[model samples]
Target: MVSAGLYWLLSLAFLWGGFVQMGYPGMAGEVCIAFVICLFLLRFILVKRFVAASVFNVAATVVFFIFIAILQAKGMTGVA
Candidate 1:
Protein backbone atom coordinates (compact mmCIF):
# COMPACT_ATOMS: atom_id res chain seq x y z
CA MET A 1 0.00 0.00 0.00
CA VAL A 2 2.73 2.42 0.87
CA SER A 3 4.63 1.62 -2.30
CA ALA A 4 1.54 2.10 -4.39
CA GLY A 5 0.91 5.45 -2.77
CA LEU A 6 4.47 6.58 -3.45
CA TYR A 7 4.26 5.48 -7.04
CA TRP A 8 0.96 7.31 -7.41
CA LEU A 9 2.58 10.48 -6.12
CA LEU A 10 5.48 10.15 -8.53
CA SER A 11 3.14 9.54 -11.46
CA LEU A 12 1.05 12.55 -10.54
CA ALA A 13 4.20 14.68 -10.39
CA PHE A 14 5.17 13.56 -13.88
CA LEU A 15 1.69 14.33 -15.18
CA TRP A 16 1.81 17.75 -13.62
CA GLY A 17 5.22 18.42 -15.17
CA GLY A 18 3.90 17.38 -18.55
CA PHE A 19 0.94 19.74 -18.25
CA VAL A 20 3.22 22.58 -17.21
CA GLN A 21 5.50 21.95 -20.18
CA MET A 22 2.63 21.81 -22.66
CA GLY A 23 2.65 25.57 -23.24
CA TYR A 24 6.17 25.54 -24.70
CA PRO A 25 5.90 25.87 -28.49
CA GLY A 26 7.81 22.76 -29.53
CA MET A 27 6.94 20.67 -26.49
CA ALA A 28 3.21 20.03 -26.67
CA GLY A 29 3.46 16.74 -28.51
CA GLU A 30 6.37 15.53 -26.37
CA VAL A 31 4.43 16.43 -23.25
CA CYS A 32 1.47 14.41 -24.47
CA ILE A 33 3.74 11.43 -25.04
CA ALA A 34 5.18 11.81 -21.56
CA PHE A 35 1.67 11.96 -20.15
CA VAL A 36 0.78 8.68 -21.79
CA ILE A 37 3.96 7.03 -20.54
CA CYS A 38 3.25 8.26 -17.03
CA LEU A 39 -0.29 6.89 -17.24
CA PHE A 40 1.07 3.49 -18.13
CA LEU A 41 3.49 3.72 -15.25
CA LEU A 42 0.58 4.47 -12.94
CA ARG A 43 -1.36 1.52 -14.32
CA PHE A 44 1.56 -0.83 -13.81
CA ILE A 45 1.96 0.30 -10.24
CA LEU A 46 -1.75 -0.05 -9.49
CA VAL A 47 -1.71 -3.55 -10.90
CA LYS A 48 1.21 -4.48 -8.56
CA ARG A 49 3.58 -5.09 -11.45
CA PHE A 50 6.59 -3.78 -9.63
CA VAL A 51 9.17 -5.18 -12.01
CA ALA A 52 7.56 -3.67 -15.05
CA ALA A 53 6.92 -0.43 -13.21
CA SER A 54 10.56 -0.13 -12.21
CA VAL A 55 11.70 -0.78 -15.75
CA PHE A 56 9.28 1.75 -17.10
CA ASN A 57 10.33 4.29 -14.55
CA VAL A 58 13.97 3.96 -15.58
CA ALA A 59 13.10 4.18 -19.23
CA ALA A 60 10.94 7.22 -18.64
CA THR A 61 13.74 8.96 -16.77
CA VAL A 62 16.16 8.28 -19.60
CA VAL A 63 13.70 9.46 -22.21
CA PHE A 64 12.98 12.57 -20.16
CA PHE A 65 16.65 13.51 -20.04
CA ILE A 66 16.97 12.87 -23.73
CA PHE A 67 14.09 15.24 -24.36
CA ILE A 68 15.69 17.85 -22.15
CA ALA A 69 18.95 17.54 -24.05
CA ILE A 70 17.13 17.91 -27.32
CA LEU A 71 15.38 21.03 -26.06
CA GLN A 72 18.68 22.47 -24.89
CA ALA A 73 20.26 21.74 -28.23
CA LYS A 74 17.37 23.49 -29.90
CA GLY A 75 18.13 26.58 -27.80
CA MET A 76 15.09 26.45 -25.61
CA THR A 77 16.23 28.79 -22.84
CA GLY A 78 13.37 28.90 -20.38
CA VAL A 79 12.91 26.35 -17.60
CA ALA A 80 9.21 26.38 -18.24
Candidate 2:
Protein backbone atom coordinates (compact mmCIF):
# COMPACT_ATOMS: atom_id res chain seq x y z
CA MET A 1 0.00 0.00 0.00
CA VAL A 2 1.03 3.57 -0.63
CA SER A 3 0.50 4.44 2.99
CA ALA A 4 2.79 1.65 4.11
CA GLY A 5 5.48 2.71 1.67
CA LEU A 6 5.19 6.31 2.76
CA TYR A 7 5.42 5.26 6.37
CA TRP A 8 8.57 3.31 5.74
CA LEU A 9 10.09 6.09 3.66
CA LEU A 10 9.28 8.73 6.25
CA SER A 11 10.61 6.58 9.05
CA LEU A 12 13.81 5.80 7.24
CA ALA A 13 14.26 9.44 6.36
CA PHE A 14 13.75 10.42 9.98
CA LEU A 15 16.26 7.90 11.26
CA TRP A 16 18.77 8.80 8.58
CA GLY A 17 18.39 12.47 9.32
CA GLY A 18 18.75 11.82 12.99
CA PHE A 19 21.90 9.86 12.28
CA VAL A 20 23.23 12.72 10.17
CA GLN A 21 22.23 15.19 12.84
CA MET A 22 24.71 13.52 15.16
CA GLY A 23 27.28 15.87 13.66
CA TYR A 24 24.85 18.63 12.73
CA PRO A 25 22.45 19.52 15.47
CA GLY A 26 21.22 22.42 13.37
CA MET A 27 19.15 20.05 11.22
CA ALA A 28 17.89 17.67 13.83
CA GLY A 29 14.79 19.57 14.85
CA GLU A 30 13.73 20.22 11.29
CA VAL A 31 14.26 16.63 10.32
CA CYS A 32 12.30 15.39 13.31
CA ILE A 33 9.41 17.75 12.64
CA ALA A 34 9.25 16.95 8.97
CA PHE A 35 9.30 13.26 9.57
CA VAL A 36 6.67 13.46 12.28
CA ILE A 37 4.35 15.64 10.26
CA CYS A 38 4.69 13.68 7.07
CA LEU A 39 4.16 10.47 8.90
CA PHE A 40 0.97 11.75 10.45
CA LEU A 41 -0.30 13.14 7.19
CA LEU A 42 0.34 9.90 5.45
CA ARG A 43 -1.62 8.03 8.08
CA PHE A 44 -4.49 10.46 8.31
CA ILE A 45 -4.96 10.68 4.60
CA LEU A 46 -4.21 7.15 3.56
CA VAL A 47 -4.75 4.87 6.49
CA LYS A 48 -8.22 3.58 7.25
CA ARG A 49 -7.89 1.73 10.53
CA PHE A 50 -8.41 4.01 13.46
CA VAL A 51 -6.87 2.33 16.49
CA ALA A 52 -4.17 0.45 14.67
CA ALA A 53 -2.98 3.43 12.63
CA SER A 54 -3.16 5.73 15.58
CA VAL A 55 -1.06 3.44 17.70
CA PHE A 56 1.50 2.91 15.00
CA ASN A 57 1.83 6.61 14.28
CA VAL A 58 2.12 7.57 17.90
CA ALA A 59 4.73 4.94 18.60
CA ALA A 60 6.77 5.95 15.59
CA THR A 61 6.63 9.62 16.45
CA VAL A 62 7.66 9.14 20.04
CA VAL A 63 10.48 6.80 19.21
CA PHE A 64 11.81 8.99 16.43
CA PHE A 65 11.63 12.13 18.54
CA ILE A 66 13.41 10.50 21.42
CA PHE A 67 16.02 9.07 19.15
CA ILE A 68 16.76 12.48 17.65
CA ALA A 69 16.62 14.29 20.98
CA ILE A 70 19.03 11.93 22.66
CA LEU A 71 21.47 12.10 19.81
CA GLN A 72 21.36 15.86 19.71
CA ALA A 73 21.41 16.49 23.43
CA LYS A 74 24.33 14.16 23.98
CA GLY A 75 26.37 16.26 21.55
CA MET A 76 27.29 13.30 19.51
CA THR A 77 29.38 14.22 16.50
CA GLY A 78 29.47 10.95 14.69
CA VAL A 79 27.56 7.80 14.06
CA ALA A 80 27.43 5.46 17.01
Candidate 3:
Protein backbone atom coordinates (compact mmCIF):
# COMPACT_ATOMS: atom_id res chain seq x y z
CA MET A 1 0.00 0.00 0.00
CA VAL A 2 2.77 2.42 0.83
CA SER A 3 4.73 1.35 -2.19
CA ALA A 4 1.77 2.09 -4.42
CA GLY A 5 1.54 5.62 -3.06
CA LEU A 6 5.23 6.15 -3.66
CA TYR A 7 4.86 4.99 -7.23
CA TRP A 8 2.04 7.41 -7.95
CA LEU A 9 3.99 10.28 -6.43
CA LEU A 10 7.11 9.46 -8.41
CA SER A 11 5.13 9.08 -11.59
CA LEU A 12 3.59 12.53 -11.12
CA ALA A 13 6.98 13.98 -10.33
CA PHE A 14 8.42 12.57 -13.52
CA LEU A 15 5.54 13.89 -15.56
CA TRP A 16 5.96 17.34 -14.04
CA GLY A 17 9.71 17.28 -14.55
CA GLY A 18 9.39 16.14 -18.13
CA PHE A 19 7.14 19.04 -18.99
CA VAL A 20 9.36 21.49 -17.18
CA GLN A 21 12.36 20.18 -19.11
CA MET A 22 10.40 20.27 -22.33
CA GLY A 23 10.17 24.03 -22.04
CA TYR A 24 13.90 24.32 -22.27
CA PRO A 25 15.59 23.88 -25.60
CA GLY A 26 18.36 21.32 -26.35
CA MET A 27 17.40 18.89 -23.59
CA ALA A 28 18.82 15.49 -24.52
CA GLY A 29 16.40 12.62 -24.63
CA GLU A 30 19.24 10.10 -24.43
CA VAL A 31 20.05 10.90 -20.82
CA CYS A 32 16.45 10.64 -19.65
CA ILE A 33 15.93 7.48 -21.65
CA ALA A 34 19.08 5.96 -20.18
CA PHE A 35 17.97 6.84 -16.67
CA VAL A 36 14.59 5.27 -17.26
CA ILE A 37 16.19 2.10 -18.57
CA CYS A 38 18.45 1.93 -15.54
CA LEU A 39 15.50 2.44 -13.23
CA PHE A 40 13.68 -0.42 -14.90
CA LEU A 41 16.67 -2.70 -14.52
CA LEU A 42 17.09 -1.76 -10.90
CA ARG A 43 13.43 -2.30 -10.17
CA PHE A 44 13.46 -5.69 -11.84
CA ILE A 45 16.63 -6.89 -10.17
CA LEU A 46 16.13 -5.45 -6.70
CA VAL A 47 12.37 -5.41 -6.40
CA LYS A 48 12.09 -8.76 -8.21
CA ARG A 49 8.78 -7.89 -9.88
CA PHE A 50 6.95 -8.50 -6.64
CA VAL A 51 5.97 -4.85 -6.46
CA ALA A 52 3.84 -3.73 -9.37
CA ALA A 53 3.98 -0.10 -8.23
CA SER A 54 7.57 0.35 -9.29
CA VAL A 55 6.77 -0.92 -12.75
CA PHE A 56 3.99 1.65 -13.15
CA ASN A 57 6.29 4.40 -11.94
CA VAL A 58 8.98 3.45 -14.42
CA ALA A 59 6.51 3.03 -17.23
CA ALA A 60 4.91 6.38 -16.53
CA THR A 61 8.28 8.09 -16.44
CA VAL A 62 9.34 6.52 -19.74
CA VAL A 63 6.12 7.35 -21.52
CA PHE A 64 6.07 10.97 -20.34
CA PHE A 65 9.67 11.51 -21.42
CA ILE A 66 8.98 9.93 -24.79
CA PHE A 67 6.04 12.24 -25.27
CA ILE A 68 8.15 15.23 -24.34
CA ALA A 69 10.83 14.16 -26.80
CA ILE A 70 8.31 13.78 -29.56
CA LEU A 71 6.85 17.19 -28.82
CA GLN A 72 10.29 18.79 -28.69
CA ALA A 73 11.30 17.17 -31.95
CA LYS A 74 8.21 18.67 -33.50
CA GLY A 75 9.27 22.10 -32.16
CA MET A 76 6.68 22.34 -29.42
CA THR A 77 8.86 24.06 -26.92
CA GLY A 78 6.37 26.79 -26.11
CA VAL A 79 3.57 24.32 -25.59
CA ALA A 80 4.91 23.36 -22.24
Candidate 4:
Protein backbone atom coordinates (compact mmCIF):
# COMPACT_ATOMS: atom_id res chain seq x y z
CA MET A 1 0.00 0.00 0.00
CA VAL A 2 2.71 2.43 0.93
CA SER A 3 4.71 1.62 -2.19
CA ALA A 4 1.67 2.01 -4.37
CA GLY A 5 0.98 5.42 -2.86
CA LEU A 6 4.53 6.49 -3.49
CA TYR A 7 4.41 5.27 -7.08
CA TRP A 8 1.17 7.17 -7.60
CA LEU A 9 2.74 10.33 -6.29
CA LEU A 10 5.76 9.91 -8.51
CA SER A 11 3.57 9.34 -11.53
CA LEU A 12 1.67 12.55 -10.81
CA ALA A 13 4.89 14.45 -10.41
CA PHE A 14 6.24 13.18 -13.72
CA LEU A 15 3.00 13.98 -15.46
CA TRP A 16 3.02 17.51 -14.12
CA GLY A 17 6.62 18.00 -15.11
CA GLY A 18 6.02 16.66 -18.61
CA PHE A 19 3.02 18.93 -19.05
CA VAL A 20 4.91 21.96 -17.85
CA GLN A 21 7.97 21.32 -19.97
CA MET A 22 6.49 20.16 -23.24
CA GLY A 23 2.74 20.65 -22.99
CA TYR A 24 -0.09 18.19 -23.79
CA PRO A 25 1.46 16.45 -26.77
CA GLY A 26 4.52 15.50 -24.80
CA MET A 27 2.38 14.04 -22.02
CA ALA A 28 1.02 11.15 -24.07
CA GLY A 29 3.46 8.66 -22.62
CA GLU A 30 3.02 9.96 -19.11
CA VAL A 31 -0.74 9.57 -19.47
CA CYS A 32 -0.36 5.93 -20.43
CA ILE A 33 2.00 5.34 -17.53
CA ALA A 34 -0.45 6.95 -15.15
CA PHE A 35 -3.26 4.77 -16.48
CA VAL A 36 -1.21 1.64 -15.86
CA ILE A 37 -0.48 2.79 -12.33
CA CYS A 38 -4.16 3.36 -11.72
CA LEU A 39 -4.91 -0.13 -12.93
CA PHE A 40 -2.25 -1.53 -10.66
CA LEU A 41 -3.70 0.28 -7.70
CA LEU A 42 -7.22 -0.89 -8.50
CA ARG A 43 -6.14 -4.49 -8.96
CA PHE A 44 -4.19 -4.49 -5.76
CA ILE A 45 -6.90 -2.86 -3.68
CA LEU A 46 -10.08 -4.43 -5.00
CA VAL A 47 -8.92 -7.83 -6.13
CA LYS A 48 -5.96 -8.31 -3.81
CA ARG A 49 -3.93 -9.61 -6.73
CA PHE A 50 -0.35 -9.04 -5.81
CA VAL A 51 1.08 -10.90 -8.76
CA ALA A 52 -1.05 -8.99 -11.24
CA ALA A 53 -0.18 -5.73 -9.60
CA SER A 54 3.48 -6.60 -9.83
CA VAL A 55 3.10 -7.35 -13.50
CA PHE A 56 1.46 -4.00 -14.05
CA ASN A 57 4.23 -2.30 -12.16
CA VAL A 58 6.84 -3.95 -14.34
CA ALA A 59 4.97 -3.01 -17.46
CA ALA A 60 4.76 0.58 -16.30
CA THR A 61 8.50 0.65 -15.71
CA VAL A 62 9.21 -0.73 -19.15
CA VAL A 63 6.90 1.81 -20.69
CA PHE A 64 8.61 4.57 -18.75
CA PHE A 65 12.01 3.58 -20.09
CA ILE A 66 10.69 3.44 -23.58
CA PHE A 67 9.19 6.87 -23.14
CA ILE A 68 12.52 8.18 -21.94
CA ALA A 69 14.26 6.68 -24.94
CA ILE A 70 11.81 8.35 -27.23
CA LEU A 71 12.32 11.67 -25.52
CA GLN A 72 16.07 11.30 -25.70
CA ALA A 73 15.90 10.50 -29.36
CA LYS A 74 13.90 13.67 -29.85
CA GLY A 75 16.46 15.64 -27.82
CA MET A 76 13.99 16.77 -25.18
CA THR A 77 15.58 15.29 -22.04
CA GLY A 78 13.49 17.58 -19.87
CA VAL A 79 16.62 19.54 -19.02
CA ALA A 80 15.23 22.96 -19.61
Which candidate wins on TM-score? 4
Clashes of 2: 0
Winning candidate number (lDDT): 2
Q: lDDT per model, in order?
A: 0.59, 0.61, 0.56, 0.58
Estimate TM-scores for all models: 0.43, 0.38, 0.37, 0.49
Question: How many steric overlaps are in each model, in order?
Answer: 0, 0, 0, 0
Q: Quote the lDDT for 79 in model 1.
A: 41
The window of 10 residues in a row where model 3 has the poorest summed lDDT is: 27-36
| Model 2 regions more than 4 Å off | 27-50, 53-80
How does residue 61 of candidate 1 score in lDDT? 57
- Candidate 2 lDDT over 1-80, as tens digits, reads 44545556767776566666656536554556566667667667655655577556556666655765786687642433
Q: 1 or 2, which is superior by lDDT?
A: 2
Which of the two candidates, 1 or 4, achieves a greater TM-score against the reference? 4
> How do the candidates rank by lDDT, highest first?
2, 1, 4, 3
Ranking by TM-score: 4, 1, 2, 3
Residue 25 displacement (Å), model 1: 6.6
- Candidate 4 regions exceeding 4 Å error are 1-10, 22-51
